[model samples]
Target: MQQIIAAAIQFNVQQGDVEANLSHVRDALARVADRGAQLAVLPELWSTGFAYRTLTELAQRTDAVVAELQELSVRHNLVIVGSQPEPAGDNRVFNTIHVIDRGRIAATYRKLHLFSLLGEDTAFKGGERWCLAETSLGKIGVIICYDLRFPELSRRLALEGADLICVPAQWPKPRQEHWRTLLRARAIENQLPVVAANACGLIGKLDFFGMSMVIDHCGEVLADAGERPGEVLATLDRQAMTAWRAQIPCFADRRPDLY
Candidate 1:
């Protein structure tokens, strides 16, 4: 991983309003570019926020949405990470994250773990595999909202030589502490930098408290977005991550056989 400037875009997501949502992302991305961000993370299902009733229709527009993202990535010279509803066979949509690295579609990851409490399993198709997008910037390991609760997925990414992790989450209230702690824990344990983007404000019946964070390998909070619709910027130093890893040596001493 090279020393790079990164950002997280946290905003109030109006469910089912693709135009409005995309507009917000575009505006935020331009500001992010102005701030010299090389990589930016967007919230999960940002394009169309789980409008289950018209999900299939929304999923049909994913290609166009991705094309726009690719263009924006090129315009900003940034690696953008975000999720949208993807059209799956059998009328089900998969929550898929697209990693656009400066005009190229670096990787597309489907959400492995569905949030059953919110009936996500019933509305969407679960992914069978994970993704690690290798870009010019770095190997970006992506984790959706619910996936944060599962350490094994992230551990696999770390074992696979991911330099950093990007989490695009729509995690809401009552579990704010879980969101913050798990993000830092992932970085500390894996000895990798983390960029997490979360949504804020009310969306339908649910109220989201955005606490998007950029964390270093030693679990230090580099930048916090707070509980509002905004963007947070941070500069990640790869040398710092390497130094911390050498100091702790957690990955080198992992007892895989014993576990």
Candidate 2:
């Protein structure tokens, strides 16, 4: 059976402190590497937290962040996935996810759905495209925090041949239940594995609940980090996923015409 070990790093992000946040992520990467993880996922806006008031000043160029992550990927020999606020030309900024594989940038996905409640729509430009990166492990799709609430986006990725999905989030305390429920729902409905890396502690006035998790296609919680700062590692069996897909055949039985 083909299997891949993945880890989600849950940590408290220091708001507006890029250097400190990057240092924290570097340490988390080491921890996951020590745990024999081939893929390490970091929380959304991990490098700068939710410094919305100073987003423009804190936002880094995409190339710079990718270069740093590339070096880390090379050193650890692992794929790393994380989101950052990046300048998008025309005085605009985008919440983008970068996927680095073996010292190279594999793909990038800009967050399509912005959270209006947090004034994200006013602050950042939403992406118009979906991104799925082909990697040594499997076909991986990327999505940000708010995107998790939309089932159609996940379904589109699954329909387009995604075996696994990674979510980088900064979900707040009040909506903790929604975060957990949506993650499992995406996994079960699409019959694919999901790895969600969420931020912990406080950022500005928002308190983040770190419940980073990995769920199997059957909606089984394989690993959960709870409301703490740490890493949760789990192995995904591609053969088992294939077998389940064959048995259930939801994708094949889809009636798009009727809909």
Computed on alpha carbons, the lDDT of every model, listed in order, comes to 0.93, 0.89
lDDT of candidate 2 over 130-152, digit per residue (tens): 99998877789989999998999
- Candidate 1, residue 130: CA error in Å? 1.4
Name the runs in model 2 displaced over 4 angstroms.
Answer: none
User: Per-residue lDDT for 102-162 in model 1, tens only?
Assistant: 9999999999999999999998999989899999898999989999999999999998988
lDDT (C-alpha) at residue 38 in model 1: 97
Q: How many clashing pairs in candidate 1?
A: 0
As for candidate 1, its clashing pairs are none
